[model samples]
Target: MAGTYHKDESNTVNRYKHQATYDVDTIHAIVNSTPVLHVSFVPDTSVPVPVVLPMIGQIGHYPSDSESHCYLHGYVSSRLMNLAASPPGIPLCVAATKVDGFVLTLTPNTHNYNYRSAILHGHGTVVSSDEEKLWAMQLVTNSVVPERYENSRVPPDNAEMQSTQILKMRIESASGKVREGVPEDERKDMKRDDVLDSVWTGVIPVYEKLGEPVGGPYNRVKEVPEHVRRFVDGENARRWTYAVEASRKPAPVKRVKKQNQVE
Candidate 1:
């Protein structure tokens, strides 16, 4: 959807309004591209402390659904599964981040990382419908490698389905922030020839590199599958391209919120 997510107290950008985005496509893109999403929720109301889990998740629309939803693959913790199964669901936060480059500045205070980050706040409930569950399962499986569900033994067995679980999160609010550029230094340092001569200012481009695939002991496939080969090669190129591009852009200006910076 081209429509943007509504900004409210819950989703407002406090400081970096210039880099913050409420666009639906931008937020979804950041989430989908990240390898792992950190899902956090309060496990016990009495304790009021949140539990964070590194989970595999993807966002997409189901055939029968009116809007897109976030689906999480949760085969790890039974406590999280139980909490997500209740009616009306539990409050959850999902965060994804990709560090593109490291911005090294003249001073430590201005040092930062070029990155893309997204946060989604939603109510997550167990996917009870078998048909929807199946679709979500496939949605998550292919997220790792394109067309993976079709390329492998799929239509999960009954036992596999029974053991696995999928949590559907109806997003209430979402937002994203992006930082890309070389380095930013205060005028005080920029004018100092000594600091300029001694300090190095540049960006170290960072990207995830996919290594050669190794087959498991039981795997009898003669060569790497087409889907696997394509995804690995394509992702490596895309990742490097983005990191380098982001590294070359003009440095971003700081817009710190008043009364927030400590002495």
Candidate 2:
């Protein structure tokens, strides 16, 4: 049965949906469960853009029937595979982390944190089907931003579509772990006045903020995009809104060194 993943009003998980740390089978199960994969790529040369969107589509499967080799789908593009086949090992590492909560403890020793994270290490192969490519693009966008595709323009053309290459990696090894609760020392420090009176003693909440929006090239007619406007008015929206506004301001110039300094 597919487990339901839900977030509370605070965006924190009240219950764990899955735990597949020790069992390889379980890990594979979770990997195959999701259509979207968050990938991190590292390139050999420093370029204007290091991350290249490879072929899209479901190009591979992990833990093959023999349980020995994972099969990657897609045309064998030398450029794409060469990066994956590099001597040092994988050129990229991809993973995801979810912040659980701030643990408040009576004593410093009892202080702790809670989080759930998954790290996937492996090489990726490009996937080549046109039908799959479209699906993959939809999956990737929706994964990061829900309903994003519904509001955005479709890919302009086939060449434009083909420009993006998708890569699939077999999950060779992976792990997921979590920690939760108050510090163990709470019992010993329960009676300490200093511990009780310190204003900063409890867990200080953390939140994501959206800030005001800056007008764009089309601002002459259209109001700020709803996406941008929503953040400005939403609770805990200041961070993003403020960042957008800051980006519009001119950047500070760096000072140059004098020609004759004691050398």
Candidate 3:
């Protein structure tokens, strides 16, 4: 699994190399965990600067057990979507990150954050076939609001489908960087009596939680559906536990042995 992605100059982490991960599971988890992904792309060759848009997308294999791609949606006439229509595809970078805690160290220099982030670089092509396009659309819609596609009207009307466009990017290379556990203060600072007595250092658990849901007007449902309620509760509990655990301590190191027990 580690060899699935070969790290290169584009995906390698220059600083804090130990925190970098090329594992498929780690990269996929980080990418799918975040709600919004920032896609940076050049609209036209004539323009010098690239445009960054907050897009809702999902990372998945479409049609069947094929290569992984990041699926993004936007208006039909949008510049980004239009750019994806080019031959071969449009070059773009996609990024997603989640913050778990804020590490408050004794000295400001050592302060850091517990986070998980993934960056995917690839060429995005506009999905032309209606069959594949619908698959990608449903994947993205469910990601935004779980079970939304099945609950609401699906197989969108012809007009609606014509107005919306989906771009599928064939991910070439990807990497994930994660920081967990508590703060690491310098040895000199930790040994200082004055600093130990005066300063307090620890991680402040930070997590994004889903608040109580509110129904809108013209709504016939009297109570929040069980599905929605379960989703909220499950997410809140999972994230909160992750933040708390990440701030507390590191996991126990695993030991590996040689086949012949050379030692």
Q: Estimate each model's TM-score.
A: 0.94, 0.49, 0.90
Per-residue lDDT of candidate 1, residues 1-263 (tens digit): 78899999899887767788899999999999887999999988789798899989999999778999999986647777687778788889999999999999999898989999999999999888888889988888899999999988878899988887888899999999999997988888999999999999999999999999999999999899999999999999999999999999997766655695532
Model 2 CA deviation exceeding 4 Å by range: 1-81, 85-93, 104-109, 180-200, 211-215, 219-263
**Backbone atom clashes (below 3 Å) for every candidate:** 0, 17, 0
lDDT of 1: 0.90
> What residue pairs are clashing in model 3?
none
Question: 133-224, model 2: which lDDT tens digit per residue?
Answer: 56666655544344566657776477857676555565455555444333234444667777677724433333344446566665564666
Worst 10 residues of 2 by lDDT: 54-63
Candidate 3 local lDDT, 147-241, one digit each (tens): 87887767798997776788888888998888888788878998999998998888899998899998999888898987788889999999999
**Candidate with maximal lDDT:** 1
Model 3 TM-score? 0.90
Worst 10 residues of 1 by lDDT: 254-263
Candidates in order have lDDT scores of: 0.90, 0.46, 0.83
Candidates sorted by TM-score, best first: 1, 3, 2
Error in Å for residue 37 of model 1 = 0.5
